[model samples]
Target: MFEKLSYLQLQQYWWFLVGTLAALFVFMTFVQGGQTLLRELGRSETQRDLLVNALGRKWELGFTSLVMFGGALFAAFPLFYSVSFGGAYFVWMAILFCFIIQAVAYEYRKKPDNFLGQRTYEIFLFINGSLGIFLVGAALATLFSGGHFVVNEMHLSRWTNPLYGLEALANPFNIAFGLMLFFLSRLLASLFFINEIDDEAIYARARKSLLRCTLMFLAAFAYVAYAIATMKGYGYDPATGAVFAKEGKYLQNLLAMPAVAGMLLAGVLGLLAGVAMTLWGGSRRGIWPAGIGVVLVVLALFLTLGYNDTAFYPSLSDPQSSLTIQNSSGSRYTLVAMSYVSLMVPFVLGYIAFVWRAMSAKRLTVEEVENDPHHY
Candidate 1:
């Protein structure tokens, strides 16, 4: 079946897979969002333990999603992986450092007499939740906003700015998207806590936090939506392989692809419905709807950037260096091999769902954390 399709088909297929993994990673960031609320939602040590353990059960999944996202990109679009990850080393390094601390914090937060102390570890989780997510959003924004890098004939890439990818911070659109993701994560986390934790105080606080985070998320999301709709996007000519800027490119993409626009609408409505259910209907199952909405929304965003002959990774330093799915993809042979490997994805997701269900079958309580020997 794989051998039957053209190379472009395979490239698009892998790009879709990469986008799906990225969407899942964004949804999983509810873990990061939950981390930021540990102090706000959990007022006591026992309550904090409940939050920590609840999140710890799923933090690794978010991290794994991130790794898989990177790996898929590296395999399917090595040029993009090298250009973005290599040229923007500082930003990527900071993100890596944040996740490293997150893993360490989760492992040793409850260890007997740890050297850094519990407060320090908690702080690490906060850093990962806020700074880590913000930077990732900014990094992804470069896909639309363009980055300061040049690619040579030999395919070598160099960063034009001294700040590396940190220059993305200068763009308000980037910051808006970053904050949007951060708050969305928080909102999802609150819904998750409401569903996963059996404590009254945590549930009440999570409900309130959901409202606040929803407002913040809406503000940031509105700004990003406006920016993307109005901004000039990099356009690629499939016939000549030329790159140029087109006004209202993203909005046009939405108009051109009604199915994707429908997805965006459905995702937004689902997200709003999830929040409303949690806020007014007192539904604990809000996380499921909200999480699925997040994945759909993110997947739609990625499709917008990659489809419509748009340059998914644009180079500000050299317009010709902009990367489209065709230019940045691996060889056809590699993609075919990877496509076969991709068949395992459904089974892997099913197994993860099974494990997640088994683990979450019982809600976390003060008693479980105090009694369980394996508690984080």
Candidate 2:
């Protein structure tokens, strides 16, 4: 079935797949968000244990999804994988270190022979949760705001600036998106805690914090959206396929693609519904709506960045060097073969859902954690 499609069609299809994976990954970051809130929500050891165990059930899902997203990107768009990962080694290394520490923290936090002690590992987990998600979001922001990198004739990319990807900090738009993701993840975490952990103090604190974080999230999201809507965007010539800067390019893309606009609207409404229900409706299941919303919103955002003759990865030093889905994707044979393999993704997701349901058969409580023989 994949044999008949053109190379451009395959590239677009893979972008859709990548966008979906990224959206799911963002939603899963709620595990990190909950980690960041461990102390803020927990008043005692029992409450903390409850929170940790609740988050532990889903932490691996986030990590696994991240790996899959990267893997899929590497297979479908090797040039983007090489350019971004090869050039932004420092930032990627830091992000990887954060996740590695999180893995260690989870495994050893309750182990008897753990050398670092529980508190130290918990601290490391908190750091990993906060910084890791924020940095990843910031890195994605570079797709629009541009990054400092150059590609040679052999398509090998090098970091043009000494700071590597850290130079992205200089872009306010990128920072805005980063902060937005941080607060959004935190908000989702709070919602998840309210549903998963059965603690009055934690629920109340998370409820209050969710309200505060949601407001901040909206503010940051608005700023980034506004900037993207009005700012200059990279456009490619249909004849020469050469990239060029065009004012209000993103705005045009949105107008040109009504389906993306509908998705964005739906995502926004879903987010608002989740937040409002969590705050006012005495609902413990706000995570469901909000989590879905995160996926939809993030997917739409990625689509906007890559589709409609836009440059998904732009170059600051040379605008012409920007990479689009067409320029960066792999050969048609590779994309077709990978597309066939992609059919297994739904089965994986189904298995994950089954595991999630089994683990969350009942809400987490202090008594359960204390009385249970096996605890996180």
Total backbone collisions for each predicted model: 0, 0
lDDT of each: 0.93, 0.89
Q: Write the per-residue lDDT of candidate 1 for residues 1-376, one digit (tens) a residue.
A: 9999998899889988999999999999999999999999998988999999999999999999999999999999999999999988899999999999999999999999898999999999999999999999989888889998898878888989998888899998888989998999999999999999999988989998999999999999989999999999988898888999899989999999999899888889889989999899978999988888888898998989999898998889999999999989999999999999999999999999999999999788899889999898
- Residue 81, candidate 1: alpha-carbon lDDT: 95
TM-score of each: 0.99, 0.98
Prediction 1 TM-score vs. true: 0.99
Residues 192-296 of candidate 2: C-alpha lDDT, one tens digit per residue: 998888778888899998998999999999899899889998999756778899999988988999999889889889988998998999889989988888888
Candidate 1, superposed: residue stretches over 4 Å from native = none
User: Least accurate stretch of 10 residues (summed lDDT) in model 2?
Assistant: 150-159
Worst 10 residues of 1 by lDDT: 148-157
Count clashing residue pairs in model 2. Answer: 0
Query: Candidate 2 regions off by >4 Å?
Result: none
Residue pairs in clash, model 1? none
